[model samples]
Target: MKVLYNHEYPRRVRLAAIGCGGHAIRNVFSTHPYAPIDLVAVCDLDRERAEHTGCMFGAKAAYTDYHEMLEREKPEAVTVVTNYDEDGRPRYPQIAIDCMQAGAHVWIEKPPAASSAEVLDMMRVSEATGKFVAVGFKKMFFPANVKAREIITRPAFGSISTITARYPEALPPLEDRQDLHKMWRFLDHIVHPWSVLQYLAGPAESIFVQRSPTGGTVTAIQFASGAVGSLHLDRGQGSSSFLERTEIVGPGGNVVIHNNTKLTFYSDGPKPAGGYGRSGDYYGGDERAALHWEPEFSLGQLYNKGIFLLGYAPEIRYFCQCVLDDTPPEVGTLDNALEMLRIYEAYCQPDGQHIRIDTEPGKVS
Candidate 1:
């Protein structure tokens, strides 16, 4: 619930941003004022876009070349949001590696790479430069998802047994899977469900995907901890419908998030006064009732802002906090990116088979 304005923060990291695309402008740069950083410059390949975005925000300068921006501005950290390479691989890994080599930490947007091998290269660069790279796995920062993670970690929650997620996405056909460009869409969007899933249920070891004729898919996952899960990528779901739902179950209860905002935690309640069908009262004690939360937009609260509600500000803050503290980020680290990319690689394989994901923790198979 902490809200710190960029200008008011007595000491802030020197931040520069690359990529002036719609998403970077809307979600990332829009959050600059709320994060703990002084945006020194904006960079993009398009000079007009760079200048426009820099002027829109309060950046002191703008440049068309990021390498030039890095050398001239010497920002302590940089946020990168870029398009994928022609091969369908994200441009982030190489960009982030370069940022680290420039002696600055990096915050890059998701789908960190097309494969685990690329993430591993980023990891190597990060270690060599001693600068951490934080991927924008925003769902991990979503307030509801954060709350769900908290609820699941409580001792009262018992062991996490399962996770179920639904997202409106479609997988490429088996034939198309061999081509990175053909997998462009799946690589871009699958990270949403997988980010929330991995954020809740750590370290999955395998996945079994079954694709519907219409391109929807039901992916079953087995975690290293012995928990099982499923993701329903509803390809043909209504566009107007809410995009996502995620739930994690524990022996004591479960927590669910709907549409990235509303959350309900159903905890184990007191035993009924009577047994089974004989129980007359459906009500439970005050403390045992289900806990629920969702932001109210009426007052213009920070939580009501799309940036905060959808996790952009929090993600930026988390990365900035790490930079300010001179420590590696705990969330959205290269390890997390690597883990998710491994699962992404699993998706690139033929569907309808139980593909084993490499689980050696950041080691590319």
Candidate 2:
């Protein structure tokens, strides 16, 4: 298979899109024109919204019910970007299962399911139907995060000793977790950081957490790789402030991502010439010095678009390409979804108590 690049002859993948909501309108649907997909149909519970999105994206048909759309269109694949219910439950697993059973591949949005049980069901359906299902874990699709994954996996970086992820979200207190309404906000948002952790480090072995009175939650995680990690939910940060910051520490180097866009790598360094009080300069011509990357917004290029810069376009293209080649997706597989759900469930229990996640190889906790 050809490696996908920014500009290339597009390989066509027939597709049906589901959900005509704000997220699909702004991110998923907008990215199809740039990917290797032909939007053949659109489906939504609201007929008017479905027709509007279908017409806007040049789809041939629109339907209020996804089952009708799948039966009529018989698309090679389907994209799902629906919103969560008031109870924080995801509605995509059943739809995805139906699409897969209808002989179409599926690309469902993040928070693949409300719980790990749902993900297991989707996996069983996919296996039985011989169709692949790729969850839209968009954070792992970002260029910076991709590069960070590559960096952390290198031999020179050694085994990752620690990781810290910061995102502006809040988890309800333990007492409120049983209420689906109270947990809904967290269920919708925690997938972002959870995906990153699973991508770079691997499955979390165990987790201990603390919930703040102000709605924020803090977690300490131990990965199967024996690396420690911290997840800080910042409920009170100003929206104007950088939304995220992540750091991964290895033997003699570390990588830091600022605001989800800028990435800097700090490698082994030489000692300063003078004493601690009289250091000469931050940079001293060391060969193994730091490296950094951030996009320049001046150019009116494809990179300037949020869909491209933030990984939405790349992720869509990846799914389409996998479908065209009859291959499974690497980033958003059922196994990854299972790991993410494990972390989500860890927060449901009270703080300072460890939760064990069952895995194929062994027990995680």
Candidate 3:
């Protein structure tokens, strides 16, 4: 298929995919037609599923074993989106290392590893083989989240004073946390909120949390940037409830992302005098003052698709672009994975204790 580009379509990257499961089938495979990737093969533990996906996506072959797929296909890149093991462990680290060793860049799903040690091992292999591993920390790629990053970095936003992130998830109690099986659900999902906080606020200096009897928890985090933040895990919330709402407050202005898609920027407006009440005017400034973006379901637009708007497609495009350009991914890099692991480890211990993270240099320490 011919790949389209804004200016000129560059050479598409040959790709092999691992794990033909629900996420891969729904999001990743659906994105191939839009990205600069040529899907050459699909592999899964289930031979039937792999072959089905391969036939559906026009892959040349399918295999039950990823190693055989990698050895035979020798594609430039691979996408790993398998499920966790019975022990609540991620199974992609070894597969990713194998792919990197075979001279292919890898893009794996979240919770890059079951532990920090696994990620370090993959990092070592990636460095030794001169290949890259991009974890799908898709929150960093969300259009609203990306815009929030830009807003916080602007001089006018000043030094980010605080951030508040709300996601519908709960952490296991401290006693149960020791068991990877008990904590598996938390470990798998905590990366979502952690990625958002780390991307916008920098590394967390310390964390203090309180868990509820029913399994909900609230964590207060202090960033190395000297910015404070809060994470609220709503355990009892309905699954149909809005999953995310984030806000970043700087010296003057602030940005709020409603439901993970609508972004609103409240720029610095003139303060009222002592005698004056709230003004009637709702509009803040000219074209530059207020900005917002949300999909109009009424129209047939690419933005309406979950693949494009929900961060999966854009993230795949990002990895493909990095490979074609021979550049390291800014997001989903090993360093980001390390930071996320640190947060996961911190939560494993008891709450109300401070755990300091060693952040990278020049990062507002």
Best by TM-score: 1
lDDT values, one for every candidate: 0.89, 0.85, 0.85
Candidate 2 — what's its lDDT?
A: 0.85
lDDT tens per residue, model 3, 1-365: 13354224468889999999988899888888778877899998999999999999888999998888888889999999998888779988888999999999999998888787787888888778889999999898888899889988998789999999999888777789878888878888999988999889888888888888887888988898899999998888886888899999998688999898899998786543333465555453474466777777978767777877789988998899999987879887888888888789888887777777767521211
Candidate 3 achieves a global lDDT of 0.85
By lDDT, who's the top model here?
Answer: 1
Measured against the true structure, the TM-scores of the candidates, in listed sequence, are: 0.97, 0.93, 0.93
RMSD of each candidate?
1.5, 2.9, 3.4
Ranking by TM-score: 1, 2, 3
Clashing pairs in 2: none
Span of ten consecutive residues with least summed lDDT in model 2 = 1-10
Q: In model 1, state the lDDT of residue 359.
A: 73
TM-score for predicted model 2 compared with the true structure: 0.93
The residue-by-residue lDDT of candidate 1 on 52-123, one tens digit each, is 999999899999989999999999999999998766778998889889999999999988888888889988
Segments of candidate 2 deviating more than 4 angstroms: 1-10, 86-88, 274-281, 286-288, 361-365
